[model samples]
Target: MQGTILLTGATGFVGGAILKRLHLEKKRSVVAVVRDSSKVILENVPKVCIEQFDGSTQWEQRLDGLDVVIHAAARVHVMNDVEDDPLAAFRNVNVEGTLNLARQAAAAGVRRFIFISSIKVNGEGTAPGSAYVADDVPAPMDPYGVSKMEAELGLRQLSLITTMEVVIVRPVLVYGPGVKANFLNMMRWLDKGFPLPFGAIHNKRSLVALDNLVDLILTCIDHPAAANQAFLVSDGEDLSTTQLLSRMGKALNAPRRLIPVPSWLLEGGAALLGKKALSQRLCGSLQVDITKTRNLLGWAPPLSVDEALAITAKYFREHH
Candidate 1:
């Protein structure tokens, strides 16, 4: 934690938050690797612009003297992917690009390399009481998940031959202030008092507040036990879709307009409308057990789900 730290994806939500936190903590030698320097707005932190992450990208100069490399940049997963070959596209960035940079970091004598991975590597969903653990046999079901799983495998292999330690953190749905995508859409729906049919959803999902994930990442930056290990992270609290929506309503001061529709009906209707994936996400269980994270690092999520939701809602109201 004392030495210089190099971070990728400085303009991204997770990376931006991490850079801001490092700045506020008065870290003296933090460097942000970005594609566009203009997109990064942090003061005093040096920005190193790398056009892209591929085999030819020169990370040697930028990685010099860095103690830790937090590789947070990647081609994120999208719902309606328009790529000709989605798996190849994902592999180009998430797998090949990741290993390309990691190899350079290890060769540069970097002490540790932390990779931010996704819980999707554990598979799409779980049974009601069964939660995913860090060491579960990987059952990645999509291109993005497969890419992450491959990157993880490559990094672990690299760690075996290199002196640099590798740490992987797999987090479930992360939401907080500046959140976007599905979480933001849900908030917009709640704020507008839109009637939703998730009132009876009993499926539980584990989500991590942005702050909690950052805290765990920072802990991994220096924790001795974190070397060559993978940790599953969450808020340690699971909530049903209905429960989540109700809490979000309270945070936004919006009325709960959810109708108590049965899960079977919703699933059936979605199947007919070709929205089975959407409905499954809303009503299926995707819980992750964070006992490894808690016991190994002695870390607990600093913010509760409600507290984090309130902060997220406040930001949404001010910005949008």
Candidate 2:
């Protein structure tokens, strides 16, 4: 924990959060790997440049003397993929690039490699009253999920054959300050006081705040039991879509204006609009059980969902 740590994706949202945390700690010497060093916001952090998805970087030399490597960079999932071979595109970065980085890290005698994986690796969603556990069999539905699963399996194989330790963390939808993508869009919609037809949504979703996810990553960095293990993490509280929007409204000081619509009608409408996937995500249950993570690492999300939401809301008010 006190030695040099090389972190990828420092310019990204989650990675930026992690870098901010590391900056405050000031205990470890952190080097950020990025395409353009000038864009790195965190000063005092050294940087190395590498072309993503190419596997063309000189990693062995770059990784030398580094104690830990936190791999958070990958080809993220695009909601509407335009690539003809989406799986191949994802494999290029998430699988091939990831394994290449790990192989070099292991060869360079790095002590540990922490991989940021997705809950999609577990499956699309969960059944009502059931949640995904750490030991659940991987059933990736999309190309992106498949790529992450492949990288995880390959990293575990490397760990078994090599001396380098590997820790895999699968996090649910992560939200915090500077959050973008669908979560950000949702926040904007709620902030504008747009009425949503999710009042009757009884489905539960497990989400991890950016702070909580960063804490887990830091825990895996030095925890001996974290080696060769995979963890499922969240805020330890599940909320329905209706509840989520209501909280967002509270944070934004907007009225909770939601319309009651049956799940069946919502699904039917989404199907007609070619937004079935979006509907499934908005109206379906997707909970992660973090009991293994809690019992094994003696860890719990320090921030409650509402506390995290408040932080996010404050940031939004100031920025957007």
Clashes of 1: 0
Q: Which RMSD values do the candidates have, in order?
A: 1.0, 1.0
Runs in model 2 deviating more than 4 A are: none
Model 1, stretches more than 4 Å misplaced? none
- Tell me the deviation in Å of residue 194 in model 2: 1.6
For each candidate in turn, the TM-score is 0.98, 0.98
Task: Please write out the lDDT profile of model 2 over residues 166-267, one tens digit for every residue.
Answer: 999999999999898888888888888888888999999999999999999999999999999999999999999999999988988877789999988999
Task: State each model's CA lDDT, in order.
Answer: 0.92, 0.91
Question: Model 1 over residues 129-200: C-alpha lDDT tens digits?
Answer: 999999999999999999999999999999999999999999899998899999999999999999999999
